[model samples]
Target: MSRRLALVIFPDFQLLDVAGPIAVFEIAERYRPGSYDLTVEAVEGGQIPSSSGVCLAARPLSQGPLHTVMVSGGDGTRDVEGLQGIVRWLRTVEVQRPTSVCSGAYLLAEAGLLDGRRATTHWSRTDDFARRYPRVKLDADRIFIRDDDVWTSAGITAGIDLALALVEDDLGAEVARMVAQALVVHQRRPGGQSQFSALIDLGGRTGRFGPLMDWARANLALPLTVEQLADQAAMSPRNFARAFVVETSTTPAKAVERLRLEAARAAVENGFDPIDRIAEAVGFGDPERMRRAFLRAFGLPPQALRRSARS
Candidate 1:
């Protein structure tokens, strides 16, 4: 008999939260035939509306004799009253069966399953979730977290990563690697991590910093310093530095470094340029420095990124 998986969708659910994990599970099915039987279930029996007002047809929760159950998060289900039924149903989940929630960890909290467990949720909800469920040890910085059979992800997209991890654990690392490859995702992202690099934070780049980020992106090859960037923002170096950090959630040096690193990674993966030239173009000054940075950031040197990207 194949394993059974259920995805619980509710009103105002983040559609990607529902889609990404389902896609991974579906892809896993392709590689290992008859591995799973999947269902999209709702706390209600049918036409549970989404945040977008589109009615999503789903099987009811009672249909599950599930090997794994996923609770998807959306704006519709965040409040305590909105998630009351799902939270109650979750309390009855079979202990031996793994129960995972995507961005829906907050719903789990409402029912008190997370009372003493270490967990994660969308970073934006950290303060509120902590306040609401004081006993749940929340790791706001992680992409996803797993405590025994209960797994939770940080936000919408991270659920896909978390689901792939569960697939890896259920089957094998190799199968997970293959699924990631097929999905065009980076392989082997461990649970309890930040999916997006903090270095890629383009936060608060709303005004002049916005166009400046475009400028920086375009001139990734140039030596861009704080003074230079400040001049472009038409502010004193000190003021610009403060504003940039406040807006970008990172220093000017770190932002420039990340852009250059991204450029170097792209150049490496494309196979159109040599490592030395790519390093120099991305402002690494030399291959050795770029090699070290690449190794540190990607766990692979330039050549390895090229090889893996090509393969």
Candidate 2:
């Protein structure tokens, strides 16, 4: 029996948000032959223009026993004040599973579908999303989150990762791997992985001390004391300490430790260097220090992360 899969979109919706997941299921159908019947839908049932200015024709929202229903997100979702019709429609739809990509969670939340559910969306919208939907437990760091029948993903590309996970669940890891290979993506990224890189999350490039941060990342093996960093930024030590906290929301020492931890983790996961050598190269000084840092940051030691990466 073929499962009915509907992808719901709206005007100015993200193009990839719709295309990525559709491609996943389409490929899965090729593998399993009659596995899925796909449809693209919109509130008005016409030519819907995406945020990218590309238009996709869609059918009007209809009620039925759907196997899966997915909603996409974009700038159109930011101010959903005028979307009460679609919100009402979403509130009344019946499906075995409901999912969202990116800010699409906003629509689901607006329709009261995500109330008291664990969900995630784009990291950059964490603050606003929390304020708007207080009942939805928003875990901004996750790549995707699933609470029972409702699945929500973060940002744009994370949609593909979420779809891949669904493929794994419906088919198996082997089918998921084949789909990922066809798509030229990692087989699956753990949902718990941080949405952004450590440096980017720390505001390394956009913050006031961005240049110093860039230099610091490249010189992780050097002694990156607060005083030394202050000198590089041309500020007094005390003022620099205050400014660093204000800009990065972390102490200078903690920031340096985070940078070193990122570097050491990459080396541990991707290279054959000894633990002690990786530790020293990333300024952790010794294996024990690196192990402790990894435990604090990732709740596991360096060895565990490497083993997980291999498996």
Candidate 3:
């Protein structure tokens, strides 16, 4: 049976939020013919201009059966008044899965669908979303969150990750992997991965530490103590520690650990290195120590994470 997949959009919706998932489903349909029937719909049918000013023709929201409904998010979501019709429809629409991308989570929460459910959206919207919908348990760090049948993803390109996951759930990992290969994107970034990398956020936030972080990544096997990092930065230990915290809003030790975690997790997921070897290479020193770190940061042990990545 072909699953009927619908993407909901509105004026000024993020174009990529709609295109990315549509491309995933479209490619998956090619691999498994008769697997999916795709539709784009709006509260009112016809041309809807995206945030980029590109327009996509959409069908009017209808009472027809839908297997999955994904709502696209963008600057338009800020117009709460204009979204009432869509919100009202979502309140009553029945689907196998109800999902949103980026600020689209706002609509689901507005419709009361996310009440008492764990969800996530673009990091920039987390504070506003939390204040607006206190009942929804918002995890602002995830790439995407699947809380039972409802799914929510972080901003923009994360929508591709969410769609790949949906494909994996429906067609299995092998097909999902092939679809991703066809798209020339990574097979998948597990939903549990952070929406943004530590190095990118901290390194580029100020150029002062970019070289240090890069050096630390390259020398992960070394003990990246604050004293060493301070020396590398040409500052005394005390002053460097103080200045680094002021610049990055995190202690030097914490930043180093985050950098280590990023490297270790990548190696764990993408390579077949033994967990102990991986831990040592990433400066965690002990397998158990790495396991604890992974659990605290990613909610999974190394082996479990490796298994999920391969799957």
In candidate 1, what are the lDDT values of residues 92-178, reduced to their tens digit? 865344444455887878877778998888755666888988999987656777787778887777888888888898888889889
- Model 3 residue 76 CA deviation (Å) reads 1.3
Off by over 4 Å in 3: 198-212, 215-219, 222-255, 265-278, 291-311
| Native-referenced Cα lDDT, model 1 | 0.76
**Poorest lDDT segment (10 consecutive residues) of candidate 2:** 196-205
lDDT of 3 by residue, 155-243 (tens): 99999999999999999989998999999885577787766465344563466788888898889899989889899989999999888
Residue pairs whose backbone atoms clash in candidate 2: none
TM-score of 3: 0.81
Candidate 3 CA-lDDT value: 0.88
State which candidate has the highest lDDT: 3
Stretch of 10 with least lDDT, candidate 3: 196-205
lDDT of 2: 0.84
Which one is best on TM-score? 2
Query: Relative to the unseen true structure, what is the C-alpha lDDT of residue 153 in candidate 1, on a scale of 0 to 100?
Result: 85
Better of 1 and 2 by TM-score: 2
Q: How much is 146 displaced in model 2, in angstroms?
A: 1.4
RMSD of each: 3.8, 3.6, 3.9
